[model samples]
Target chain A: MESTQATNHVSYLQHKPHKIGILNWILSTDHKRIGLLYLYSIMVFFIVAAFLGLLMRIEKFAPGETIMDAQTYNGVFTVHGIIMIFIIVIPGLAAVFGNFFLPILIGAKDVAFPKLNLFSWYIYIAGAILALISQFASGGAPDTGWTFYVPYSADSSTNVIWALTAAFILGFSSILTGLNFIVTIHRLRAPGMSWFRMPLFPWSIYATSWIQVLATPIVGITLLMVIAERTLNIGFFDPALGGDPILFQHLFWIYSHPAVYIMILPAMGVVTEIFPTFSQKPIFGYSAIALSSVAIAAVGYFVWGHHMFTTGISYWSRWFFSFLTFIVAVPSAIKVFNWISTMYGGSIDLKPPLLWAIGFIFLFMIGGLTGLVLGALATNVHVHDTTFVVAHFHYIIFGGMGFAFFAGLHYWFPKMFGKMYNIKLANISFIITFIGFNVLYFPLFIIGLQGMPRRYFDYFPEYQYGHVISTIGAFILIIGIFIMLFNFFRGARKGEIAPANPWKGVTLDWQIESPPTLLNFDEIPVITEKPYTFKKEEEA
Target chain B: MEDKKHHISSFNSLLMVLIGLFIMTGISVMITEIHFSTFSVGVALLLASIKGYLVLTYFMHLKYDEPIFRIMVFLILLLFAIVIGITFIDYLLR
Candidate 1:
């Protein structure tokens, strides 16, 4: 497979058609370049949002008005949630890794719709810029929070409209990306790469694309309704105009709950790739993991009501949602079981990527279990809107998706950049990040159970202890992230050249050059075996 | 890539589908005059679903496409129905 391809072809990085300096990247229709474009832009937004999160943590260190007023605090957290959710995590793995690797993994030269792939990035940037503008615009940042619940959002003096419009536009970007992936996966597979023969990452992307395509429009229209309620006084959610606010919650969570799956499924897919490669073994249950991705997406749709369990929805509705929420966990748990079982009998190489992959499983398990605590109707009422819910969310989003993003980045860094980051530095950074992340979020659970609410600018002195520990953890976590990123930056610039197959793994991406050429392969290879095929001879 | 044969619908087939849609629209508007109380919205939705099925099957050419596509469409409709039904659980129970 390696000997059949051209060895001297120019990498996509130095490929020449778009000769303009910056325009070479921004205007390029290449999927790999477009994937990097998403990577760079998402990194920028992640830094901004992480800074905002750090600021909020700082303010919470001391009980009363540590740095900013309550209004400013509201604005900070709102912007943080908006950027992190919309710009960073939702498109995090799929946009960056899926775009870059999905085609190569499936033995295609590029995605089915390459131009549309680039167009999605442009739309994403447009939406991201609009979100940033909402912060600096005339009326001040939106205080409605990211959810933009009605009545307050409809009547808020702040720039809620800008935020709403930004979210709506971002939803369009999501839909387009999803649409592109669906077409690409459907149409662009290599000759013999049957459905089951394709890797788990593409399978996860396929499932996530469905959620993105079908679920995003609901949020798009829901956001538009809020805009209309504000601008036209149409009263879609305003009680004064005979609208139901609970209905808004329903519409929002209908998409938003499935949106959680959108965020995590790709992360799951990333780790699925990492676990098998690092363990040097066949995946435990290929069909189960692949089908579980689809199951999570499908069942993820009906579990939105769990988020609204405390919102005065009917008892039966609450019960139904709770039951479905628990049911959704089964597929996720199946995935976790499969991951752990893959590592059980294999000769495991615990490198930086594997460490992060292991970290993802640990943290995601905590996140998933706590999610069950919240899924239970009785327990949810106890912790609803508390820091406990906040902790659960960060664990899932940051611990699950965020950690998996880092794991994928490290795993594919050599392949993507043809450079090897310092292994010691990456390992140290992961340790710091793992410790800091838990330190930052775990206390919130304790304090939340002790009766501390979330999104509040101040807290009682009793809660100050937890807040201080959590803030310290935030600083440590931020330092670790910067170090990890800096290591990658240095590696990309001046590191040892990486081999085609750094981990000696069996996958199409690994079989190709370190940094793939303009067109990924000289010829699309026909797949004749399942992904993650490990033999004893190769292990030796 | 596998070569796929494009299915082109004929003018008479398209015209018949259009006429069927128009007749359904007229019936939909006329049915508003006499409706069962709680089932009015249900009736309207059922008619709309039929029209949608017609559009998807003929106009959208699902009838001519692969069986997998039809399965996907059916699954999506099932999902849509389940979501709507669950949402109604809240409203009706309330």
Candidate 2:
């Protein structure tokens, strides 16, 4: 059945660039245009956030005597984290790539709710603008870290309420996107595309949208309480007002810890696509990998307590959280094993996307293992508030989410723009980014172990060397990212034209012509067999 | 064509959603008059859930479309209950 639609898609081949007008982009419902809108908007937000980090890094390059004062540095880092995570990275992979590709992958014309898809983009931008404006209006961005923990969050005099409200609105946008994806995947699959036969990327997205729809509201409500407490004096998390501040942490992490998966799962989806196409084989443990995506999403929700282990939570509660944390790791490990096994003895092609995929495996493993160390009650007491925790999260976010974003961009570059990115530049970019990222983040592990706390503007002189090394590494990493942007920009406008199946991928999207029609198909595809069955039907 | 047929039934669900919206707002305002501290909020929420459920079942077409969504919602609610319940347990035990 999948083959029927694949062959039937030959009739549709419309690729005239849609008017390329400002009004067309602003008001468009076409998923590709909307995706480009997201791509450009998120890139701008990332630049703003990245600049804030650079300013702070320069301040901390030495012993941090006085490039910026203490409160200013705190506010800089806070805004950096808030803008990058909330405004950019949170929606980075799924909203940009998943929105563009999922419907295409499933052989559908558009998302389930096309207008809602566009509305989500507008809401995301509105929230981002509001948060950015708060920086100027509210004396500076909130001094509270992105986590916005209570007591500090409850007591802080900065513009925390505006930031929290913006985050809540952003959560609403994410939830709507998730809901649209869920319904679209369920109802809009072309005639024969069964669950097993669908592309692995969309399957992972399917799992991710569930997390978005279900878990986002928890944070939504939590952030609202913070705003209410600040403005209305509602005391839900204020101890003085008969509320437990620690309860705020529980509520925050409940959404946040799963949010870690929210950041990484789509990356996992990208790797799932990359491994099969490059290795020239079906994914080993296809059902395991598919179900594991769902398993991570489900189990990911219960393990938030592990984040609060050192925060005066009860002993038994700590044990429960630790145990559940271990359980969540099993599915994550299963995915790793499956990817490695997929590459075992297969006719592997060493493409740029493949390099990033393999890089993700190596770095993501480091991040995941260290997470166990922190998940344990005894060890967490030592590392909970330190630079080690900061380092661990960067490895996961930078190494995990950041690497996956590049991999997906490269893997789908041809499909997205009907052109090939400079392979040489891509490989160079990956190498520099990988080395620079580790150089920047890895030392924080050592300094963090030696008792350096996170979110502090001033540090002990003993930590000066690590800080300098990290500062230098940040420059290298930024250069690598700059190379990526240049390569993609050049490729989109002037690179070699891409064929329909540039990588010889087996997914439904590649079965169609490059720069697929607005509707994606002249006829809906039907599926009769499993996806990526490269061995049984060898294609050399 | 299937697209046109699907459109007609889809409109029924949209109308049901609008009807649920009116019912929810009416129930919420009326409950303020009854005025029982926790109970009022609880009853209002219960009515809201019923409205949401009706919207889900009839409008979203969950009754016939797929079981995964219903199960997903049920699981989410179950987890919410567990988190709130366990927190309350610790409070009582202390």
Candidate 3:
């Protein structure tokens, strides 16, 4: 099983400089290149989706001077959510960074199945193409939003079938990637690396992978039913054929709610890695952080019904889900406590990565705590579909997950490309993105409390001011993201060569040289202690 | 390393799980004849669980993988249980 000393010979290792053909990039199976490919493609989709979001905000900026009509606004938000959830966030961190570094971090030459990883990318692209095609084929991208709840999803005038089918295809891709990562982690850890010794990012990805393999199929089947009922007139979810609409709500949320975890869990892992590296200390309660990941995944499953409390779920079940939802918060809080404890009395470096990690903790705390307010049966009934709910999720998803992602990208940019980012520009980008995100989303909490419902193209005149402020914030957020992107692009190509461990981290991935050779390591290293057991001499 | 060897040798267990899954699929389809509609779905899912268990233990080689992987598989079943249980409770109470 050990192929020690043999030169690593992955297929794309021999890629000549001038051989950068479209077919070469498309057909390649090299994990690093594939990861870069995913990074590029997902970023492209993110920009497109962000543009749609900006359009939505602009249309609503002044209570509708008529930039985009109501129907178009619906299409805009739906497409924005679809692209962001399906295209960028879900795949971006895991598929790009996970694929790039997990095997390398573990001292493996490649994932157990290289070909399957490439195929997953193809499936993702295919799903993306099908969804994009629907924009032109019918009325527009499905206006049902990403959740695509039953009656609306089943009966929407737009091309809902294509979107559902695309989602189903993407689910298979996600499941396969999950299965691959699970197998790789199980079978291919470097000789000395025990499960307990693995890095937190991989630990987080492991939890996310399990969620993906299990929950993804349910969504696959659920969406398949959506397509089936529409095409064959089955009564599985469509209300017209004796199918209960609430059943659709159940089936949809069963997957969609956990889907939120799928989006957040990996970012949690990324933040877990960053905290240790930048704080200049081993993570406090390492086992607790690792186990809490699993805890969140396990508890995440029971709480999907919280999303449906407003839609007339049974009172008993509502109470049960609401309780479980609150229970789920405990583990998340444990993670926050562990992170804060890691920073306590430690020689913390306020580097860009650490800044974002701290930012994530602050915003995620706000989000997770507010989530309890939403999970309570009484409180949710009032704010269920309002901007409060929207704001809460944005805090968690965008503020929590999005900021961590930025932190991770900056932290690893040097390692990924053997270059150093412009710290001044990175800091500026961070400030703009953070402030803009808060400005864009925080106002929603206030307006929502004042009775502003979400998903509306236009609103009351008084609300117009809030919407305008939010729209301006969205612009600032986009500019910040662009600046970050530009800095990274320039840094990667021309910046200073990164040392093997630029941040002086102790993870196995940092043990390897920057821009590692195709096989990651010449020899599979063994581990004996916790990953961040920093030597006392290095501390001083 | 120990887990990998065990998985490599569990070829028989994998086959057994496949056979069991197919059998459960047959039983689920056959149970449509039983007059109780809710009972049929329950039986079908029960069989499906057995099949799921078999696959988790054998094909996925979780039986030989570390305790954590096994814990993961169990966690998934627990989740499945909660979803089905709550949904049925609501369905019946209604």
- Predicted model with the maximum DockQ: 1
lDDT digits (tens) for residues B1-94 of candidate 3: 5655674745676676677788888878887777775586777777777877777667676777779767866766676787878887888865
Candidate 1 local lDDT, A1-540, one digit each (tens): 443335667888878676677988988888998999999999999999999999999999898988999999999999999999999999999999999999999999999888888888888999999999999999999998888987788889999989999999999889999999999999999999999999999999999999999999999999999988888888678999978899899999999999999999999999999999989889999999999999999889988999888789999999888999999999999999999999999899999999999999999999999999999999899999999999999999999999999999999999999999999999999999999999999999999999999999998999999999999999999999999999999999998999888997788998888799988888889888888987678543
Which regions in candidate 2 have their CA more than 4 angstroms from the true location? A1-20, A535-540, B1-73, B90-94
lDDT of 2 by residue, B3-87 (tens): 6434235776678678878978897887778868646545766787788777767776677654676897787778877876655
List of chain A TM-scores, every candidate: 0.99, 0.96, 0.96
DockQ of each: 0.68, 0.23, 0.48
Quality of candidate 3 docking, DockQ: 0.48
Better of 1 and 2 by DockQ: 1
Highest TM-score against the true fold, candidate: 1
Query: Candidate 3, overall lDDT?
Result: 0.83
The all-Cα superposition gives candidate 1 an RMSD in Å to the true structure of 2.6
Q: In candidate 3, what are the lDDT values of residues A328-443, reduced to their tens digit? A: 99889898999989888888888888888888998998899889889999989888888898899889888887888888888888777767989888889999988898889888
Chain A agreement with the truth for model 1, given as TM-score: 0.99
**Candidate no. 3 TM-score:** 0.90
Q: At residue A433, what lDDT does model 2 achieve?
A: 88
Root-mean-square deviation (CA) per prediction? 2.6, 4.5, 4.3
